[model samples]
Target: MDGSSPAAAAVIERVLAFLDSKTVAACKTVNRTWYTLATIQSARNIDCHILQLSLRIAHYKRKGLLKSARSLTVDVSFVDGYLSPAAYERRVRDAAAMLQSSLMPVSHLKLHASSAHAALTDGEIHHGTTAIGLLTRALPSLASLDLSDCPAPLLTASRGECVASLGRLCRLKWLSLGSNDMSSATALRRMVRANVRTLVKLDGRGDVTDPTMQLLMDAPQLRQLDASGSGISDDCLLALVRKRGASLRELILSDCVRLTRHSIAQLTPKLLPQLASLDLYNVPVTTDAYQSLFNAQTHWPYLRDLKLKAAIHHASSRQESRATDDILESIGRNCPRLVSLRLFGCYGSTDSGLSAVLGNLGYLRELVVMHHPVDPLIDEEHSSSEAGGSQSGSSNTPTAAAPAANGPSSSLSSDADVWAGIPSLPSNGLPQHSSSARRAVLPLPSTAPSSPRPADAASGASSRQRIFTSGALRNGVRSQRFNLLNLDMTYDSECAAHLAKLSHLHTLCGRMITRHAKSLIEAQFPKCRMMVWNID
Candidate 1:
């Protein structure tokens, strides 16, 4: 062991690299060489919040770890009311000193003070501003600077020192000053202009407006941009898109309520060939623009992940055409290599559209369509109750007979249990539902007409006489297969059966199916994970 070869030492070093921070930290005590190597690998990305900034600074200065570290994250918001004023000030000074001292030029630095009390006084803001200024000024080689969620009043109190320091970082690539109090478009433009060639990602989600859009246009190398929750208008967004669309790979414009069809009209596959991931949550576009987005000729070879959750019409009175179905069909046609898809709150999509889309995309790994429209046939009970105030007059129904079979007291409890997420269980933890309650929830038809009805009549037939039945969910596993089966859509017994039949189904989510259907699906595909909602 004393005369170990260089190969063995290399092997040991590689092995230790795979281990976690604590293990590598522990291994440092084994030998000097191991200590040096472990420090270089793990200490480079220090979380000052976890280790405590005071301790990390002392360790860094003493052990010469700061020189090797490339990234550092300091969270000093934890120093709150527990510490005395004097002690808190001292901690702040020490943290500030560490940031100010350039023992090593850090490339990436994230200083988070958001968790600090919302009632941060003027004095506290000034102190924070001074600290941020010191840190930004110290790291000239800093490529990625995330000073997000800093108390705005504090940044404003610094007399533009923090903003001025940011403006000097010529090598900055990814900058996130989002959720801050400052709204000086001049100062923001200066920062963007300083690193126009290098800036790749900018998150101005807080106070970014039309003015900042001009500076964004200068950043030709920008790839991923997030302007969510901003007041940027269609003109600004369009300008940014036309300027940076070619280089942009990922774009998140969620909750930019002002964005209209004109803003997204230029985002065709031909224009943004490199764009892969797009999130347009709550960004309203017109019917024509929506259709143009997924045209037959539109093709994004690398486009894989897309999120259109709650991307509804901005104007309630507009009566926009339902494009959810067309969008899904287009995604299947255009983005053939698509992997992850999320359609949360897509009210336009129906059961047929969903089935058709799934049938087309065999390579889908993650599918999440929460709040999918319920099938009119399967969710008959809900529709019936809505149509007529509770069918109490129908004495033949199990719901009416429930009070007679069990006492009136038990009937109310049973009815309460019928509500999703609530179950009437005994001491044993198993639910106790009466036969009448079960029959009421899923009633079976007493009789059926022998003769087949006309096409017109059959198409318009009501679900009142529809019979409820259960069988093995895996009866058609080979026909309609999928990789990730998440039936979180509204309850459709037929759909649940179809999902259960997928042999490759790995994850089942949602509360659409009944207990009986759940049991069959779980039993057949025991390996598949079921993500149950707590309030289902």
Candidate 2:
């Protein structure tokens, strides 16, 4: 058989595919071609736990083949005594020696260890010293270095020397240090200052303060920043936004509680234009402030994902009502490209506010309004009735609605079932009526028992008092609580019925009986693709 023929080439390809599944040693003896292909595939990506890699290093050294590795990942987790102080030092030194001697041209080096590792503790200076020495010597050509979940306190405590060592990683473009115990912001500042020019991503959770953020802003090359669960305040966020980092594409500020309307007003207009995604979890921003930010128009045109988490705060009086209204209105008119919106705890937003915002964003694909006050009122009422009926004599009846020291409702239930029986109105049925467009007026289930007499009411006047005062039984009453409560129940049933008519909606998630209502809708409108109920 001629070796250069097409048939021979096809045979070689088939043999190579089979060899890909076998181990290097098994493939080596198959043929010279198999040996070359197996070795190349094996050298392309090397991932080893610290212990395994240490053992492998010793074996490779013994075999005089350590220099063949091109990519290496060392994960030093606290498993099977491998992360003990002595073992950690030994592994680090061995890995470093191997890298220095044979892997100097390594392009990708990932150093991942759990926070519990002994060598990652500030108190154990010897372990940190050895680990830092190893990292400094082993990672010269690293294009990606992820020191994620390494004990930050230990790294910070060894600040001066560790920072100097980290500076030696001149080619590092991606870095993540999320969820560490780095108490001193100064250490992080030093690290960023030393390597900002080459760094493209920084995950400095719990250690990024305003000053450190300022230093990062100076790094013109930074494109992605994850400050989630960090102690960063609005001041730090403002500083970050104000600084022109043209390369930035994603910014995650989840759980940064100090962000307020004032900070959002200052930052949104500046950062929105450059950012492709922004996560503002539990950040307090008034409607007017959001409107002002959206008014800039230039900011959100390029935004693909804008998450406004818990966008509302409890207002003290009616004076702030207009501000909240303006915010919802602005969001609806602006942000047309939003794909995901999670308003999990924004109590100030009602169905009207949500409709205002969501109605305009035709591109929304993933929406999570769980636990927020934005659920249909009918759904909320059905939930309350079910809960109240279940625990009329027990203390748990109102447990779901109890407010904190500050007055805010606890959860929002879906009222989709309330509209279960309503006739299918045309899509354009409520073009003039904003609420009517999505409105469903389902018939109340015959199964719903009549409203039970207030258990505590003893007389006619007392019964009226009991009915009104029942709002207090559940939680602190809003000014229009009773009226809202009744409407919530009514609307919930109505909406559930109407939802059955929407044949185009693929998925719908809501509360208790809403699921039943969704099934009924699916039965009526078989074209409706998916229905999920009782989803919070």
The weakest ten consecutive residues by lDDT in model 2 span 477-486
> Please, what is the whole-model Cα lDDT of each candidate in the order they appear?
0.60, 0.51
Model 2, position 502, has a per-residue lDDT of 34
Give the poorly placed runs of model 1, Cα more than 4 Å off: 1-39, 49-55, 76-102, 114-116, 158-160, 181-187, 310-321, 371-485, 488-506, 514-528, 532-536
* Weakest 10 consecutive residues of candidate 1 by summed lDDT: 417-426
**Any idea what lDDT model 2 has?**
0.51
What is residue 234's positional error in candidate 1, in angstroms?
1.3
Show the colliding residue pairs in model 1. 152-181, 421-536
Instruction: Report lDDT (Cα) of residue 235, candidate 2.
Output: 70
TM-scores of all candidate predictions against the true structure? 0.70, 0.62
Alpha-carbon RMSD, each predicted model:
8.8, 12.5
